[model samples]
Target: MATKTRVPQTIDAYLAGLEDPTVRKTLGALRTQLRKLLPKATESISYRMPTFKVDGDAVAGFAFFKNHCGYYPFSGSVVPALKSELDGYATSKSGVTFPPDQPLPAKLVKTLVQARLAEIAARGKKPAAAKRKAPVGRPATTGFRVGVVRTLPMTAPELWDWVTTRPERWLGPGATLKAEPGGQYEVPKRRGSPGVRGEVRVVKPGHRLRMTWQPDGWKKPATLQLTVMPKAKGASLHVHMEKLPDAEAREAMRERWSKVLARVA
Candidate 1:
């Protein structure tokens, strides 16, 4: 079998290789937005896509494909909320796509990149400061395990309503949840910022949610399962994340799920 082709270095070189005019133009606009919002970003390609790295780590990236162009916001989870405005475009968990003839929302794109950069800065320092030693033992391999449990003070149906109807109320600042399996859930760039422009993933209500969460370049899809157990007063929520590549990612996912669940509950 032949080897996969490598990605280009600079954003210009990467875009130049695309055969579709629409994908090329959209990527060009994204490039402009990245440079304007993050002056210090170093442009390159990672994972066969154009990536913008900051302080030696990728913050954002974009890709031109046959049917759609992918816009990656490395810090997808922590970006300022923008769920309402994103309705105009087609979006998935990790990125958004603009139709061939449509003009991209340059301003919103800049806001997303900046928000992701800020989020990276907030989380990057923790690993260094903690400096904990790793245990010398065979680690447990529990292939991706994702589940969601019920939150307190709410009946299963009530929590379901909140998740399906008013998701943003608990998910975070300017975030919204959807009820149906294929429905759309959004997180706006910021409170009252107009539009929901974050990850759009599989919404398996009362069961699991499979969504892409990348505010920048690294586009890995993560799935979360929400298990609701009936309690005396309320329901106990157990969230399990699964199918992650390795241990470090699994740990980070645990923390992320815990935080999001805590915010919602």
Candidate 2:
């Protein structure tokens, strides 16, 4: 069984769930920095995590996990722009993970935020022929339905266990799963009901697990993979889903899966 951590209903609730005093302080500082950078940005919880928006677009987000913390600038562009200054940190094109005890430098954080702002502000300057799809909130075709990665303060083995075993604390009564390749993963559609069926295509204990995930309306199953990697603090949980039928399906399931992933974590 995994430790029981309360799900925050709001951004305040989410911040309050930060058990470490230092974590709470660091996140508070980061939030303050974000506000100063984007004074007009609104605060909201997108993808079940705390996020800040500017002009109705997501500018940044931050979250605390078991071992470390994460900061997302909502674009791959920002990471590369500041990559030189981010050496000695684990960074991907999307975001970076830093030790919670020692948050990323204030200057670097500011630079990352500034890069994102410049990217957003410069959008209007692009030539009509060179314009890319509209930003997330606008009307533009998107690449994937949803793509996200989260880090936690737990070892790979622990995260692997948590991912394989689930409780009905949130969605339903309980869940049934196996920790092997070509295994079964069934959960109740509702409390006290028969489980919706699914199968695991690949399982590497404590490292990676790929499974078939079928939602309620699906004509066929789309593949969902959970890759767990060791982190300085605990582990990094990477999730990807594909074969969504349409943009509507992707948008709908993106929210639903966001909630489900938080719980499964």
Cα lDDT tens digits for candidate 2, 1-265: 8998666777788888888999998888888888866677899988767999977879899998788889999987568545557888998888889987898787888667655654454343335753454575664432333443455677888877777774243224656777587788766677433345578877666766666767666677766666665655666565555566776766665566557657655
Cα lDDT tens digits, model 1, 167-225, are: 66644566665555455556666543333333435454553344444322235544444
Candidate 2 Cα misplacement greater than 4 A, ranges: 1-7, 125-265
Task: Provide the TM-score for each candidate, comma-separated.
Answer: 0.46, 0.46
* Model 2 poorest 10 in a row by lDDT: 139-148
- Best TM-score among the predictions, by candidate number: 2
Which one wins on lDDT?
2
lDDT (CA) per prediction:
0.57, 0.68
Q: Counting only residues 3 or more apart in sequence or on different chains, how many pairs clash (N, Cα, C under 3 Å) in candidate 2? A: 2
